[model samples]
Target: MKGLLVLLICMLTATSVFAGKADTVKLRQHLIAITGTSQPRNHQHTAALDEVATYIKKEFEKLQGQVQEQVYTVAGKEYRNIILSMGPADAPRLIVGAHYDVCGDQPGADDNASGVAGLLELARLLHNHRLPFRIDLVAYTLEEPPYFRTEHMGSYVHARSLKEQQAEVKGMISLEMIGNFKDEKGTQRYPLAPMKLFYGSRGNYIAVVQRFGNGSFGRSFLRNYKNNANIPVKSLRAPAFVTGVDFSDHLNYWHFGFDALMITDTSFYRNSNYHQPTDTIYTLDFRRMARVVDAVYTSILNL
Candidate 1:
């Protein structure tokens, strides 16, 4: 029965890929809670920001991570970035981050609450695990307009500070809109027409996107991520002209010359509810989202 034993071992290995706190139900509840937070347009709400920041900080503490806040101000308004660290203090750290703010007044469930949920799930699964490098889970503020792409963005500030500290940064992984998925044909669109033929017209996969000349980082991570993932994952290396590649917090890391990639569902390319009041809990696929979180864990361990 040698063949039978081999098959059994293979099944067990696959099952272990998603073991522990990568629970889809729990992930759904977390996303729902985040989406329910207040979303105020045109103005940054310090109260809402503090509420999420506190929640993130406490969650990390429960996992025994040392939590820190990077507080700053823009135009006389205050903001904060919730930071948590695991592994050795002297090692070069790997970053896992997601922005928590919404665009204007939208519920922003898919735009980012989902990404934050993924980050939390990762923190939970990675507990007690040892790695060669440190891992930092960062919850950022103001990734959306009118602050997007500006130096005021929480990610930009964090990246700059890390550079100044001369912190050994391995790289940054930014999760953005990882909840939306589609199976029907013609559901996906691209900024460039030719991409449709190369990538396909179905919005049914998670994307690991890196800028040109950085294929080594994104491709390796994407390969490791897809190795154990049950869901579809597409990896791409393109220039900044390719829309959505630099759409999230990862762009800041790239600006600082750090190798970074975005893990996403393609955002507005697939989700019609993007940045709209209609973007809510019901529009996302929590199961697939959980799979993405698990993949991130697996990729980090493999890296």
Candidate 2:
């Protein structure tokens, strides 16, 4: 009986690992598709943005999700937010969002393509999972400059619409930039220098960024995410006044009184290629990126 018990434990551990592992090949394929466009996917490049939105919509549909386009116009030009709703329809929502827009003329791989790739992979992982709450995987546009922090942003439109409709949103997580990491000792930097005392100086960890009083949903997510983390996971809880805390689509959700946090690789603090043309698919680490997605998927399931 003792030997049988030990064997069962080992088998369970192996199964858990295998089940939580994100498909690295799928992650790479999604990244390549998003970054391989001939023109940059910026607001000015409406056609490219539309194409990416369509791709995201189709990918979600392939998972047999109830996908829809949240279309809105900005400066008379139309932009879209692709949404994939799953789980119980009437339950409170748990939003997982990523922007598909890039800044300037860069490929925006780490800037956001990584986040979208994670979103796509998460959709695949969540397809058949039975959960109690509704999960909305959204790919937003106009998170880039000239529209960022503006009402014209796709995230803003979605959040506002949810508010108008009085939808019950439990919390939101923005996969901002989940592909960048560095093992070098001095690769990581923080908004406040004193933070080094707690977080150290390596950019090898994924950060769960939250604001003060992020509410019960945010706290519960942090707990579950840390419990399921495979790679290094560090959380930064600060007020919005702290730089980079509210820099993603989650900020729009916050505006609508929803609890939200961002899961990121610390962006410019670690990724020097941020917003540069060099932020291409080549700069991403797909294996580590898949691990990030795995962590998120398992965490949400545990939730």
Q: Which predicted model would earn the best TM-score?
A: 2
lDDT of 1: 0.86
Candidate 1 segments whose C-alpha is farther than 4 A from its true place = 1-18, 38-43
Candidate whose lDDT is highest: 2
Per-residue lDDT tens digits of candidate 1, residues 16-108?
A: 754653788877877767776655422367777687778878788899667899999899988989988999988999899999888887778
lDDT, candidate 2, equals: 0.91
For model 2, give the RMSD to the true fold: 3.5
What's the lDDT for residue 19 in model 1? 67
In order, candidate lDDTs are 0.86, 0.91
Query: What is the Cα-based TM-score of model 2?
Result: 0.94
How much is 23 displaced in model 1, in angstroms?
A: 1.1
